[model samples]
Target: MKMIKTSMLTSVIFSFLWVSGGTALAEEPNLEAESAILVDAETGKIIYDDEIDVILPPASMTKIMTEYLVNEAVKSGKIAWDDEVKISDTVRELSLETNLSNVPLRQDETYTVKELYEAMAIYSANGATIALAEHVAGSEGEFVKLMNEKAKEIGMENYKFVNSTGLNNKSMDGQHPKGTKADEENMMSARATATLAYHLLKEYPETLETTSIRAKTFKEGTEDYIDMQNWNWMLPGSVFAYEGVDGLKTGYTDMAGNAFTGTAERDGMRFISVVMRTDSREARFKETAKLLDYGFDTFTYEKVIEKGESVKGKKALPVSKGKEDAVTVAAGHTLSVLVEKDQKEKMTPVVTLNKKYFNEDGELIAPLKKGQAVGLITIENDKDDEYLQEEMRENVKVPLVIQEDVEKAGWFSLSLRSIGGFFGEMWSGAASFVKELF
Candidate 1:
């Protein structure tokens, strides 16, 4: 299969971006905020934000990252869900001293790794979280290292972790010998939270299945026989509760107020919203629902190209040493352009084929491969010409190739054909020469 030249491929892709528009959404006015952000989960576009870089304590919301690490390790076979873990003396005492969230583990009691994870994810159990951290990395401090590494990998620039649970006190350093102030246990900005949330949703789906549930009972053997409920109070689907909302976590502390990371999907589009330091749980719920509503109402998903659809305006490829005369190529994936409601009518996609397609004689040429991109399908705004020099945007390429192998005739047959072809060329050349002389 012949590879398409780089210049040709480059020309094709750049031409596709110009096809759309709207009154660009107004940028946010400069202002201080505790932290807030909205992002398109699929495209990773920041829709709105404030104070994204200002790191603040994430409270229990810190558990989101903890759960993410656990899920990834399990999925990668670094750890098994059913692997049993023995609780350390430190973990047992802390669970008693603090009225923190937990599944009520006894000293030295063992439970499968999966059970501990379920408690942490579903109940936001701080004790369960620390236990899992210890089990995975042999110490909470090391697990914090892995957490920071993961944060960097996910593009979180202004984040850090001091402990497995997010409840670290700014004064207490986790490394201090007992009774020390927890030193800013976990620090994250609204932007980082949204970024991490988006990555988790796109990369691992099983997490949502557990987070979305309202309640789950601990398996029969793990210490306390109590069933724990999710702390995310907005789940009931009330007035401010968004429709189609599912699979997320909630956080709150006296210092952080109500912090929530939420997700909702509708009409094939998904959005992630984070609100921090809201006045009350009710207010946090109300604002999250409103943000999701604004996103859905203002935009819609537009399918720009259907899979296997023929590229418009692209030239068909001339064949080389193939059975078929020429091959037709089309878009590999359904290319969709998302835009505001009113801009749909103004968009138009134009397809262009290569001009230097066939050889001098109108016969198929050699060595074509199917699925090779011969030309691109472009999209352009009809109105863009009014303001811009080039009114074209290319979207996707249509490929052309040999439909079937075109073998050269056998030696004897080719010899006969060559004589005829030679005679034809001679006669044509002589005619041209005579005309020129006259």
Candidate 2:
């Protein structure tokens, strides 16, 4: 089956490899889920979309925010991997609930931050999730604030977080954290979830290091050890394994059904996909695969511009009071966007100069250093392709820089040029006057 999938992707991408004129390869996928979206991980391009903004329960996928915060805390030096997190009454009680996904935690013992994180990441352990949340925020309630704050920061719309764990509050054994009510669960739109995952991967790429572990032994060498299995079936060696698939979260609940935020890389391209409320685990994975297939099959990753390449009519920036009238400029770096085979031509550069380097007349001041950042050039789609996140539009822009130095003109040189300019203007007026007289 894996071979078949690989074969199919190659055939589809190959047929359209040379396609031109911005022809889209196929219709958007008919995903069997309440909402879905597919995005280019690096370019933030919305390759496909469905009812992506409908808010719904995300089940264990809420742990994504938890994972992101833990990694962020470690990075910020606020926490340590070896930091010990003691089991709280709430965590211990939740761990004892056999009905939920978890590896039991002993009240008399404590675990390292890394151990609990792996359990939550790989096993969807509700208890471990709450433990890590408390460790980070002093309480799960405070963690929820951080979660929503981060949501707004990332531009997530139609999202809510009543608790750190995605479990329905009523099922928190009546121990739901403060500031929330019974029966409330974490909720997010498909777009919101994708946006969250996108930022998580981009900001904390080391997150993949943990999420990629298919199976691990929690508390490995002790009497409390439990072997935890990853819930993401699309992970390598799993039943629904897809090549290049790694490091993401999955979800399931009576209300949520089956949901997944999946990412995979092949060649130089990586794609992120979200499928919400599918009928079953199998359906979710299969739908996610279909979403990924569309990204890989339909879109081509082409370098639209090369570093230091000149754009038409943008070869240089005008200078004021300089030995040379202008300084040479070019793209500070190459810019690439995920484009349909034919859509490559439709992406155009929008260059906006940085005003700090310029005067009121919009000319660069003389004495500018070579390779100074002067502005940014963004690649915009002429076809009005809607990006999943507004920020994606901004991600494709490359910094613009000066290619050479333009020394300030000396006082004598300035005077000479001013006189030359005055004479040049007089000659232009004389020519016009002569033409009128004739």
Candidate 3:
């Protein structure tokens, strides 16, 4: 998995680029929000951001991690979507603990796993989340451990979990306290939340089905049905305008005001954006729109190299003692780039062919075996030198592999080839020595 460095567009250059699209670069909007980030979901590339790593409360966006663990369990067959779940006393107990968001439930009310999942994803229901926590791990404390473990698995190093729900140590009496409570606040960086959300989308697509639902009704043997509407207002109304805006989650608190983690796919390009602690709900939407607009308009997603396509301009490598003359070499995976529209003309893929095979002459050969090491191709743009040096440089190299198998020659053929190679090496050395002597 090659991490390609992307060219960064400066504000000055970005202004010029926006004119090409006919939209006067809007005043660099004031995003006084506490934390913000935008990422290309497919490539896990940070397209835009501000204070991304500063620790902050995630609010309901914490549910993304909860959804991640549950979805993973489902995919691994440890949990079934239709499996029945009983609302244990712990679930009811937690519901009492948090009243801001919940699907009111009575003791002994039973619901299916899928229904609870929907409530948690669509409504950010605290009760449903606690219910899931208890069902999956027998206790919220154990579930918090799993949450931290999953975070470590995904390289979210700066994050720690004290609870599955994103509740930091708010004084039970509204009094300011010190010590771990100061840092013990359950929190995730803007970057971490976005990264976790990106991983969830890649690994468990079913979350989208639940997260995107506008509203759902749950009837768990209760007299009244609890209908919950999705908090992400970008679905159709109540927020910033963008086509194809599906879902994600929304979060809010006195400390973290009107936060939102959102995703929308347009023209096959999916973007994940997060804004935390905005002054109001509208600001969150407007800032997210600005960030997303910058991402979609400034850069175009392109498939630079298709998987299994032979690396252009690379010659067949020599394979030593192989039956075949040469091996076909190609990229093992697709190489895609998100670059400024203007820079596309100057982009080129630089290929580094690996010497993985040999010919009868004791020289390197190609037409290598399937999955055999071939080389790497680095895609680069002439523009944005700073970005090229920083973010895009690491992703420059991608694995090149043999496109197909190269069979070794028969025993007699091998014997003959081996002898020929020995003479070839000897003659080459003698010729080199003679040239030096002359």
Candidate 4:
């Protein structure tokens, strides 16, 4: 392994402008939502945040988790999109509740998984979400367990789900499942909500097909055919439509207020924005647009290293006892960093070898295998004078691995190499002593 640091010029003009109050260094949009977050969908980098850590009721947004689990079950072959789902008494009762968002599921009728999914995604139907959950897990209680487990798996640390439909049990008018408390509702932070969206899109990108729909007819050509319209106004053709806004989920309740998790893509860059507890329905979409625009306008993804590419100055690593004297090394994977658009050219890379891989003599041990991680290559922007500080710098790290295998040398070869290494050390020490005398 080797260490290499590249120096680059900083954006002095921008720094001067910021210091002189010409413009703030980090200019963020003022959002009206109680809590909101915007994250890079591919990299999970936070572009803008306000009260993102505060936990609040997520309302219909809880369906996102239900949607995720249903997709997971379908992908894992536990269920199929065309599989028929029997509506239960509970689901039928939920559909009859005029106060809840539903598609009027019939107890005697059955629908395909895809139809139910469309209802949940497009209309935020509470009954449809519950039906899908019950079909996948056999019971809403069991499905709620799966939702919490999946949330933890997706890095949602501040989420709690009492029901799959995101409805407050009090609103159920005593029809809620047994053991569900009246005050129970899903609660999650804006940051966790954004994290969930990131994982959902990364794992199951096909969900965009459903979330992007502006309007569709479920169970078409049948007596039960119902017109479903997307609740997310940020989609194309909506009153507040924004270009590139395709997905995700929208939520509202008297208690939870209006909330939405929106995703959009432009020029190969995709972002997820979550707005929770906004004063009105339009505020959520408006604030989300501000977040998305801020991200795309300010930052861009920069590829720092390509997979299978060797780190500069790290062509080969010394081997103590092997078939050959040294073995080549290279980066194990591609590394990219999200930086301010103006700071792209100012980004620098620093590579450092892990000290454990080397001996006291600074030689790599023998018997190294290909793809073994021996060091790390970090990429950072030099625009900030405080680049050394981890908190203030935007950087990414990729593993540096041995590119080829180095087999152990025979006893005879090892002895010969040891002798040569001993003399080399002695000669280096003698030369240093002579230099000091001079």
Candidate 5:
């Protein structure tokens, strides 16, 4: 959908020239992580995959899902930024724990949804997260169901959300979300984590505006003000800051170790990266930098196929019964992909008419409408790289559409054509018999 933003056929695609082939590639980064992956945020193209499918505790990184649901609630008018959320005993008690990330939420105190969400997203505050979850779902445990439901709806595989806060149930003080075990924790594979981030950024890009905040005071100027610093060190002016690095979640626990879901955009290309079970706090961001560096240094986005570009051999398709015998077609829109800086020529377009538009005998039926998509031109490459999420494969494809309307043939014309076709078949059969006899 990134390339589809343009008017389907009006604008011209400028030549994006890059050096193709013959240069040595930067040595692929060797990561000290249990699982890691790097993908183009726009296309979900997997640039680097190291144990990507391995399931691991996601730590506070679980908040991404919470953030997504909050956005959904706000957008659906189920909740509002200005809505007051009264702190509960659970929230008050959790905020008192000195070990967990938190902002003070006093009993009987009510804060706006906007304030709690900023605390949850910016500071990874567990207490504020639970308050927002309860505000949206009536309870944090009920909110866990929403998280898993969303994960499945969005194509995440084998993901488990036992709590809304990405904290261990044991850490929940006997108040873990219902239907979850006391010892359980939130779990997701590297691929699933990146996929969640992808949908979060794509569906609700505004989440970044909060995540990108380096420092802010919660309820400033009041006794309630708590100076909050974003846990993501990769943002601007922070230690280990990486340019173009924006808002994303970070996580840590004894079982999950140091993990980060980091995203950065450079020169119009953005990448989402995940590193799980890295050694320490510093290592997570450093490892994420390696991934971000690899993506920024390695690939450049390219629109390999222009809108209305003719597929090399597929100019038109035979119609089963139409005023015209065939319908002319071309690529309905542009085809874009993340190509290695030196390997632009490797992308290939594979064209096939959609079977849904064809009859049982594989004939396209008419009347066919002009500008209606009839086929797909999929991008293939010599590398055969797989996407981080299998569903993202659809991103590398564009529709092949008819060039003009085709009216159905009149019955009289169809009858005449049918008579001619019968004679033509007879003649061809006789010729074949003659050739066999000879």
Candidate 6:
């Protein structure tokens, strides 16, 4: 897979001018969010982006990492969902803080890891998040170290995590661990947040089972029962409920404004959108819906080449000192790329022969085997003669492989071919010089 920036409105504007001979460009969606991004869930392709790399506060969206680590622990057998965790005094006090979002827990009470995870995921409960972090790493400070490590491993650029709950030290009422300042808060760009969401869903898709719960009761049927609701409004029954929308998280704070990471599927195409620092809570979901709609309406995955199919107009490669004089090459796999509906006609595959397959004299070597990679096939958009103008846009790349084995010729045959090749080269050079003189 090749990583390339999605064709943004700016690029599209230029493309329109070049394609239509100076015609007016089409209008694009006007999003109200401060930062936004859309990505293909399966390929991590950025379909749209606006100020996506500008770092900003992430608020409770940070809990996604908290939930992710907990799931990792369970999968690794380090902990079980059914295991009981004793509520520490620090966690109980943090839960009681009036400024923080939390579900109250008794200091003497014990709750299952699964129960706490649900509270943290659905409600963005800071207390529950801290409790889980401590349970996983033995201390909030240690857990925070793990959070940064995981973020780095996931390829997150320009992000920082001061706490698992996403709260600045000011919101913690001076409860922050030593060496941490009061104003520090978790921060990440919208693009990095989307990247994190992609890996989180890819590795543990079952997390959707928890994030999709619209409403559920913790400690059901007991006097201690507390009802929790998912904060993400993109889910079903919400004001901006979108079809096929499911599991993800939402976040907000005075510094972070309103933020959300939403995922949806339709006709086998799944997408992830991240909107951060919107003016209002509703704007986050609204912008996300627009992004997803743009993606589904504008682009689609089209297969441009089939595996084992020979490249059109390409000749077989000459094989020196081989029983077979030449060998055919074909695509090793089906090549598919996401392209705009109208631009599909411009998509073309260009085959580039690998220099390593040839000898110093530019002749293909013998003993070539079937399925051995011999070249690269790059998918390019050539409408408006972009490729000829040196403005080529590459979407994806696949390998071209030899289609059959070419055994080396015997010693006697090799000697004869060498002599013939030398004479053939000399004659070709003399003919080229004579044509130039004429």
Poorest lDDT segment (10 consecutive residues) of candidate 2 = 16-25
lDDT of 1 by residue, 134-227 (tens): 8888888788888889987666767777777776554222432232245455678887788788778878867877777777788675446668
* lDDT tens readout by residue for model 2, 31-132: 899999998888677778888889999988899999989999999999999999988888888898889998889977879999999999889999999999
How accurate locally, in lDDT, is each candidate? Answer: 0.67, 0.87, 0.72, 0.83, 0.89, 0.82
lDDT for model 2, please.
0.87
- Candidate 3 lowest-lDDT run of ten: 171-180
Error of 5 at 427 (Å): 9.1
Best by TM-score: 2
Best-performing candidate as measured by lDDT:
5
Per-model TM-score, in order, reads: 0.72, 0.91, 0.79, 0.86, 0.88, 0.82
Ranking by TM-score: 2, 5, 4, 6, 3, 1
Candidate 6: where is the Cα deviation over 4 Å? 1-26, 97-99, 362-366, 382-395, 419-438
Clashes of 1: 31
After best superposition, candidate 6 residue 321: deviation in angstroms?
4.1
Candidate 2 C-alpha error for residue 430, in Å: 4.5
**Higher-TM-score candidate of 3 and 4:** 4
RMSD of each: 11.7, 5.4, 7.6, 7.9, 9.3, 7.7
Please write out the lDDT profile of model 5 over residues 1-438, one tens digit for every residue: 756767543233222122332455567899999999998998788889999989999999999999999999999999999999989888899987879999898875669999999999999999999999999999987998899999999988858999988888997779887788999999999999999999999999989899999999998887877899999998999998999989799999988999999999988889999999999999999999999888888888777788988888888888888998888889888888888786667777878777899998877898989999988898766237688667678888899999999999899999999999999999999999999999
- Candidate 3 versus the native: TM-score? 0.79
Report the C-alpha lDDT of model 6 over 1-438, residue by residue, as the tens digit: 122345476687788888986644234568988888888776676767788889999988888888889999999999899988878788999987767778888866778899999999888888888889888988888888888999988778889988988887687778774456788988999887887888789899999999988888877877767788788888899778888788698999999999999999888788988899888988888888898888888778887889988778664778887899888888889887766765655678888888988988766899989899988887654332221012113336678898989999999898888999999999999999999999
Candidate 6 root-mean-square deviation in Å:
7.7
Candidate 5 vs candidate 6: the TM-score winner is: 5
Error of 2 at 366 (Å): 1.5
